[model samples]
Target chain A: MRVALFASCLVDLFRPNAGFATVSLLENAGCIVDVPPEQTCCGQPAYNNGDKDNARDIAKQVINEFSDYEYIIVPSSSCAGMMIKHYPQLFEDNAEWYKKATDFSAHCYDLVTFLHDILKITSVPVTYQGNITYHDSCSSLRETRVKDKTRHLLACNEKINLLELGNPEACCGFGGTFCVKYPEISESMVNDKIADIEATGADTVVSGDMGCLLNIAGRLKRLNKPIKVFHIAEVLAGMTGIAAIGDADDTKKSEPSS
Target chain B: MKSKSHAFKQQAADALVNVSLQKALLNAKDGFIVKRKKAMDELPEFERLRTKAIEIKEHTLSHLDQYLEYFEQQVIKSGGTVHWASTTTQAQQIIVELCKQANARTVTKGKSMVGEEAAINDALEAAGFEAIETDLGEYIIQLANEPPSHIIAPAIHKSKQEIADLFKDHHKKYNFNSKLETIPEIVNEAREVLREKFINADVGITGANFLVAETGSTLIVTNEGNGDLTATLPKTHIVISSIEKVVPTLEDTSVLLRLLARSATGQEITSYTTFFNGPKRNSDIDGPENFHVVLLDNGRSNMLQNENHEMLKCIHCGACLNHCPVYSAIGGHAYGWVYPGPMGSVLTPIMQGLDEAKDLPFASTFCGRCEEVCPLSIPLPKLLRQHRNHIHHDKLNTSRSRLGLALWAFVASRPALYRPLSNSFIRALGWLGKKSGRFSWLPFASAWTQSKDLPAPAAQSFMSAWTQQQAKKKSSENE
Candidate 1:
């Protein structure tokens, strides 16, 4: 199966390891993974900011670029949600584009859902040792319905112990531009999320979306907490040996296993 | 009500550091969510009921004119009067005139968001009628001289101590001055004070939860039975309600009732679900001598004809508000309007003008929990986005933010331009913060850096690395 990876803009710029892990996971599942160079963003920023024209243009670009692939997978549920749920609505008035958007959306899936539901991959060969908690990105939990698929995949690794956050479903408040627009409210929400993370006493917190990971990791760093944050793809791909998000480059250096 | 929504940012900031308000919010948030979940879990047909309720509301809203007319005709047949008000001022004038006609010196009110929207208490007070709130929560906030932070639970933002203080400060004149220590004590004191007002009041007013057109009856659901007293005790009963509250029949109302209490307070039903038809006929036993329904339009007609027609379907159960993270963080007062939370964010801008409530729509993280938990299946996030689109079109958003979005959209839409631009930007940041892997402060991102550190970019963009890796693989396969 030829799958085009929509390495969401956050994963593209902030943390490529997640993108690499997604590629590795997909490749290991016996799929031919194609990184579509034309993909820049899933247009969530523009869409969420209410810039419909730009969002529509960006959506068209994404639909045109990845339409040929058998499947289009995004590591972040937010971006996948943009494609699977929102893209059709973006082109609702234009029948031609609407048909194209819906058809394209049909084949699009978030990485975990793609792995768990479509590929029927019960487990990966990678293993990690840690008491970790999972944060449910709002888009993952509500948009793409990625509640148990992630946990099911994580349970495959006997070495990993998953402790649940008190309220895993609450948003971490990255909200694309909302953090910048309403920093005070965003700070309060993320603080609540961090308190929940801390209550579990998990040394590591993992999530599927990089936007949320970055937000949670950034706050944890600012507070100078010892908790580490990693994208679910990195943990599942056994790439946790690299420095965790928001950590110093040399902090978690480990011998390369490959 | 005069809008303080334009100052939403400042109000939200104030709400954040308000120790008492924060305590109140923390205590209130989880209970509603948990109770509603439990109630939903207990009912196997809740989802089916929600869908039926949506259909009923949608049908009624589509034919709102007919149902409202039918309701008015039925009320007139039952010897009652109906008044139409296009705006809040008009609604206030109509109510005040009714009070004057009834020779009302004192007025009692049941909990009504529509009443709040019209500022009816303020209007009544200005007109020399001593307006008293009968609902326990409303009475608490009335004494404190504040607008309700939550629709159903008017004093949800007030801690018990705050309520005790408000009562102590105001209740001394009623000969009940001891600081109320327990919940029952507070309720009993409020009931004692309000009992006198409810009996002495010449006119009683309540807001309708739903207007049954088939019977021309206005319905109110309350736990305290304040609505019943506010409707039946006084000689004249006035119902201030929005036009969208009308449903085709009592059967339709029943479908919505099932969802309402469960969604609002997670009860199978409110303690009192009273329906008031019209004035007391000679055959009637105990009821108001005169009945009047004031149908307030207040921008709802415009809403019915526009993109916001779906909002009129809201039963005001406040399930969206309960589930909203932003509402949980800042509380309703910060939204600076009568209605608050996801529903308020959408309604405030439309009713008060986008310029006044511009920030309300943008306040959400679009977590989608509001829409997820909404009983009527109101797509609250989508409605908020529509408001955002209107703001963006009207250039209501700050020019700096607008420019930022425009710049981002420009580069993000074109991959060829975006790839190198992002590559260089990330590489520069990566090199600058190579040692720390994060930035404690950045020049333009003060909003984010103020509260949290910004994580550094990866050394190479994913596309850049992927291209190189693909080329290496191609060369290796060929060799």
Candidate 2:
């Protein structure tokens, strides 16, 4: 299978390892992967901010960039969901573009969903021995229906222990501009999320979306927590040798679990 | 009834630090969410029923004018009068005039949200008619001289101890001087005071949960039976309902009622689901001698002309409010209006004009949980986004944020520029935060860094790393 990696702007700029792990995992699953550097964003910020004109321009740019790929897999469900669900909405007024948008959306899939549903690769040959909890991003869970597929992939890794987080579907308060716009409410919500994460006593937290991972990791770091945060792709590809998210250096051992 | 939606941010800040309010909110949250979930679980056909409810509401809204006319005709045939009001003030004036005509000195109310919308109690009081709240929650807030915070549970923000005090302070006027300690005692004390008011009041008023076009019957669902008493006890009963509340038939009302109580308080049904048509018949044992239905338009007719016509399908279930993360954090007072929560966030802006209530839409996380649990499937997040779009298109937001978004949009749309600029920016940030792996503070990120550290970006962009990997792979394959 020929696959194009849609490294969301967040993953491209902030967490490239997750993007690389995505490529590695896809290649190992017998797929040819390409990183289209022309791709910039999924236009969610503009679209969500109610800037339809700019959202349309950005959507057209993204659509044109990955239009030729047989499969467009995004590591971040937030970005993938935007492409799959909202791109068509942006072009409803323009029938010509709507056709192209729908056709393109059909080819788009979140990374884990692509691996499990389309590629039929549920389990990856990866190893991790510590207890980890999964935070289900709202877009991925509700929009893309990615709840059980991710757990199915993680469940295959016998070396890893998966702890259930409370109300995993709850928002992490990183609602694009929401965290910045209403800082107090966002702070309170994320604080509640941190308490739930702590209750599980999981050493690591994993999720499919970079936006949520960054938000949770940011809070965990500010609280000076020892918990490790990794994108699901990183663990699935056995790429935890580098520093976990929100950490400056790989000062700790490469494999803390074993 | 005056809008405090403009000061939402400040009110929300205060609510955040309020210890008593937080404790009360937590208790309400546990009770509402658990019961709702269990009730929904017990009904295997709940989703199917929700679909039917949505369809019924949609059909009714599409033909609202026809239904309203038919409903009016049926009410007239049943010897009741239907009065139309284009705005809230008009509705209030209509009710006050009717009260004056009936020579009413005191009017008892049954937890009417529309009454709150129209500021009827204040108007009636200003007009020299004592307006008494009959429902326990409404009565508590009325005595405290406050608006109903939550729609169904008006005093949800108050603690039990606070209610006990409120009763002890206010009930003394009714010769009830005993200090109420328990929940039952407080309820009984209020009931005793309200029973006399209900019996003596010349007029009674209530909000309709649904208006049956087929039978011209106004239906109200309540847990404490206050609405039923308010609808039938006095010499005259007036229903303040919006034009969209009219349904085609009683059967349609039943389908919606099945979801209403379960969604509102998680009961299979409320303690009272009463339907009364017009005034008392000759053979009737008990009912008001006079029946009146005030169909208030108040921008709903205008709302139907726009993309927001679907908003009229709401049954005022309050499920969206209970499930909303924003409402749960700040409580209803922060929304600063009669309506609060996800439903309030959409309705307040439309009803009060976007300029006055623009902040309400932006306060949510757009989590879509409200839509999931909504019985009518109101598409609350979509309506909220529409409000945001209106605000943005009209330039209602601050110029600073507007300019920032414009600049960001320009950069983001151009990949060639955005790639290099953002890539270099993050690389620089990564180097600066090398020690902490996160930044405690960053320019333009005070909102996030105020309470949380921002995760530092990687040293290289994914595009650059992928390029290097490709070159390395080509060389290895050639070798």
Candidate 3:
């Protein structure tokens, strides 16, 4: 299968590894991935921030870039969900563009969902022996319904225990650009998210969106916790030995014995 | 002065940390949401009506001016006085003048959000007239000296225990209440109390759900039939509603009405979809002697010219509030406005100002639940994002966010600049963070680090890694 990668703006700049992990998983599943150099943002920030003019231009750029691809796969569920779910409505009045936007949405997939549900490639053909907990991103859980697909693929890891965090689908306070805009409230929400993770008794926290993982992991780092974080794609890509971040590297990472 | 869209973090934190308020809100939030959902689920045609409802609202908004004129003529033709209120103060002035004209001492009200928007109750009381809210929910909120938190259930933030306490404390003032027990008992007590006020009321004030332009008829749906009593028996009947509530015909009104009840309280249809065309007919046995319709424009016409014209299509179902995670967590008080939830987030900024209500839009998780469930199908999140974009241009955003945007925009605008910039940034953070495999508390990102650790970035970006793998494959094939 020929797929185009819409590596979200966050993954392209803040955390590139998630973008790479997504590519690795897709390629190993026998799909040829194409990274369009002409790509830009999906205008979610512009749209979310209420700038229709700029959002329109940015959305047009996305449509023009990937309109020809048979299928588009994205690393982050939030960004992908925006295009698939919201793009058609963005161009509602313009018949030609609206049709094109809807057509594009019909073919886009979030990485984990694409791998487990769409491609049906369960195993990474590699093993990882560790206990893990999954942190469900709000948009992915609510919009794309990524939890089941993410869990199905994770279950293929015979030696891993995927313990669920309390309020698994709660927002981690990294609501796109929400963290910086309302830092105080963001802290409270992430604090609650971290508390839930701590209660889970799992040393590693896995999530689909790098934006959420980064925000939660940032807070945990400040608190000096022993918990670790990784993108679901990296784990599903047979790349578990290289802990993404927050794990004690040389000091021996310990999973919860229970 | 909650901004149209503020950051969810600040708002949620402020709401959660308010111990007494949070405890009060927890029960009320669950009660309304669960009840409304159960009501909505019982009707299979509920979803079908949502689409038709949107169609009717859209139709009304597009021809609002024409319909408003038509409605006014109909009301006047039907022997009812039609008054246009350009502002809230103007609307209150007209209503008070009507009260004085009739020499009215007591007024009974039936759940009007437009009244809250107008601040009408204060004006009536200032004029030495008593205005009693007949709705149980509104009565509770009136006693609490708080704004109605939710649209349908006005005092939805109050618990049964808090309510019992409130009545116990205040019941003696009204000369009642030996004992009040159970939800049903409290409900009965309120019914008994309000029933007396209904008969004695010289004038009745109620907000109409929709006004039929062709007939100049006022339509209000209530389960308890308080609206009927409020509109009848009294010598004067006055309706305070925004100009946007006019529909061209009764058929059009019916279409919207079907969805309004289902989405709001999950009822198939409110028990009383009462329509009052004018004052008592020649042979009518029981009807008001005087009928008045107050058409309030106040910022609605301005919204018509703006991009939010679609928002006027809202039937005021309050479904958005019940489904919103942000609203569920904080309740309506934190919104600091009359309107709350997804609709409030969009409307507050426009009615207030973009600068003042900047945090309102940021309150949502952008979960799309509001958009999905709205009877009018308003693109609430899209409108909210527009508010934020406006804030960005005015430089109203905080220094941290503006800085974050500038930094991201600079590198992200170009791949060549972005690639190397990302490489060093990721590697440096990833390397430094590897001790315990993560660094606690990153400087400059203290707000984020305060709650969670930054996941160390991978040593490499996806682009370079993919390219490297391809090169290795080529070399292996060549060898």
Candidate 4:
């Protein structure tokens, strides 16, 4: 199968390893992956902020680039959500673009859901130690209904201990531009999320969206918590050799050997 | 009721640090959420009922004018006066004139979000009439000179201790000096003080949960029997409600009542579900002598013509507020208006001007939980986004962010510059933060790094790596 990896703008800049891990996971599942060079963004930030003109332009660009692939897999849920759920909304008035947007949305998928449901990959060939808790990103959980897919995949990995955190469905408040617009509210929400994560005593926090991972990991780092954060793709590909998000390499190398 | 939505950032910041308000909010949050969940769990047909409720509201709203006309005819047939107010000030003026004609010295009120929206108490007081709140929550906030925070639980932001203090401070005028430390004591004090007001008030005003056209009755759902007393014990009973509250039939009202209590306070039904049809008949012994219904449009008609017509489907259950994460985090006071939470965030900007309450639409994270929990299934996030669209298209947002979005959009739409530009920026960010793996501070991003570290970008952008991979693959294929 020819799969075009929609490495979202965040993954393109902040965390390319997630994109690479996604590719590794897809290839291991016996699927050919294509990273389309012309891809930019899914136009979520603009679409959400009500900039329909730019959002539609960005959508046209994305639709032009990825329409050739059999599947367009996004690494983050929010970006995938924007493509699958909102692109059609962007072109609700125009007939020609509306059909194109709807047709393209059906071919889009979040990375984890694509691997678990579409590819029928039950387990990853990689493993890591210590307790891991998952933060359900709001877009994936509500928009895409990506609840059991992550847990189902994680449950199959014998080497990883999956612990569920309290209120896992609660948002971590990394709402694209929301975090910056209302930092205090975002801070309060992430603090509550960190407390929930701390209560579980999970040594590592795993999430599907880099925006959420960055928000949670940043808070954890700020509070000086020992918990590490990683994308599910990174852990699934056993790419734990690199330092966890928001942590120095020395913190990983000179660990307390738990 | 004056809009302070623009100061939402400051108000939310204060609400987060308010220990007392946070404690009060935390204590009440679980009761509403958990009980609603349990009630829905017990009833197998909750989701189906929600669908029916949505249908009822939509059908009623689509034919709202016809139903409202029918409702007015029924009210006049039942010997009740129907007054139409196109604006909130008109509603207030009509009510004040009615009170003046009745020679009302003291007015008793049941908890009414509509009354709050009209600023009725202030208007009545300024007109030289004593307006007393009969509902316990309304009474507490009235004594404190505050607006109702939550629609159902008016004083949900007040702690028990705060209530005790408020009662001690305000109930002294009634010559009731008892230690009110517990919830029951505080409630008892309020009831004791309000009992006389209910009996002696010449005018009683209440808000309608649903206005039934078939029976020409206004339905109010309350835990306490304050609404019944406020309506029955006065010589003149005035019901102030928005035009959207009208329903086609009593059966439709019943369908809504089933979901209203369950959604608002998690009850199978409220303690009192009374329907006041009209003034007392000749044979009636103890009831109000005159009945008046003031239907306030107050921007609702404008909503009907806009993209936000669906918001008129709200039943004012407060379910959205309880289930909303943003509402739970900041509580209702931060919204700084008569209505707060998800519903308020959508309605305030529309009711008030888009420019007046500009920040309200942006206050949410668009979690969609409000829509999920709404009994009417009102697409709240969609309405909020509509407001955001208005704000954006009208250029109501800051020019800096507008320029930033413009620049970002320009770069994103062009891959040639975007690829190389983002690649170099990411490499620079990575190099700068290689030691800490995060940036404690960065230019133009202080708002982000103020409370949380900004994660550094990866050393290699995906596009560059993909380009290198393609080059290597082509070379290998050539060989």
Give lDDT tens digits, candidate 1, residues B270-308.
Answer: 998999989998988889999999999999999999989
Q: Compose the digit string of candidate 3's lDDT tens values, residues B442-475.
A: 7876655555555555455555555666688889
What TM-score fits each model?
Answer: 0.98, 0.98, 0.85, 0.97
lDDT of 2 by residue, B50-128 (tens): 8898889888888889999999999999999999999999998999999999899989999889889999998999999
Candidate 2 structure, TM-score to reference = 0.98
Find the candidate with the highest lDDT and give its number: 1
Predicted candidate 4 versus true structure: per-residue lDDT over B1-479, tens digit per residue: 67887788889999999999988888986789899988888879988888888899889888999999999999999899999999999998999999999999999999889999999998999999999998888898888988888999998888888889888887788898888888887777787888889889999999999999988999898889999999999999999999999989988888899999898888999988899989999998888999999999999998888788998999999999998888888998888888999999988887778888888888888878888889988989888888888889999999988998999999999998899888888888888887888888999799999999987776778778767777988999999
Model 4: how far residue B30 lies from native, Å: 2.5
Instruction: Give per-residue CA lDDT, model 4, range A173-258, as digits (tens).
Output: 88889999999999988998998998988899999999999999988888888899999988888877677889876644412110
Complex DockQ, candidate 1: 0.80
Order the candidates by DockQ, highest first. 1, 2, 4, 3
Question: Against the unseen true structure, what C-alpha lDDT does each candidate score?
Answer: 0.91, 0.88, 0.77, 0.88
Query: lDDT score, residue B428, model 2?
Result: 91
- TM-score, candidate 3, is 0.85
lDDT score of residue A234 within candidate 3: 67
Candidate 4 local lDDT, residue B75: 95
Off by over 4 Å in 3: A9-20, A34-47, A50-71, A82-108, A112-138, A141-172, A187-207, A215-230, A250-258, B1-13, B31-40, B176-196, B464-479
In model 2, which runs have C-alpha deviations exceeding 4 angstroms?
A252-258, B475-479
For every model in order, the fraction of real contacts preserved is 0.89, 0.78, 0.53, 0.77
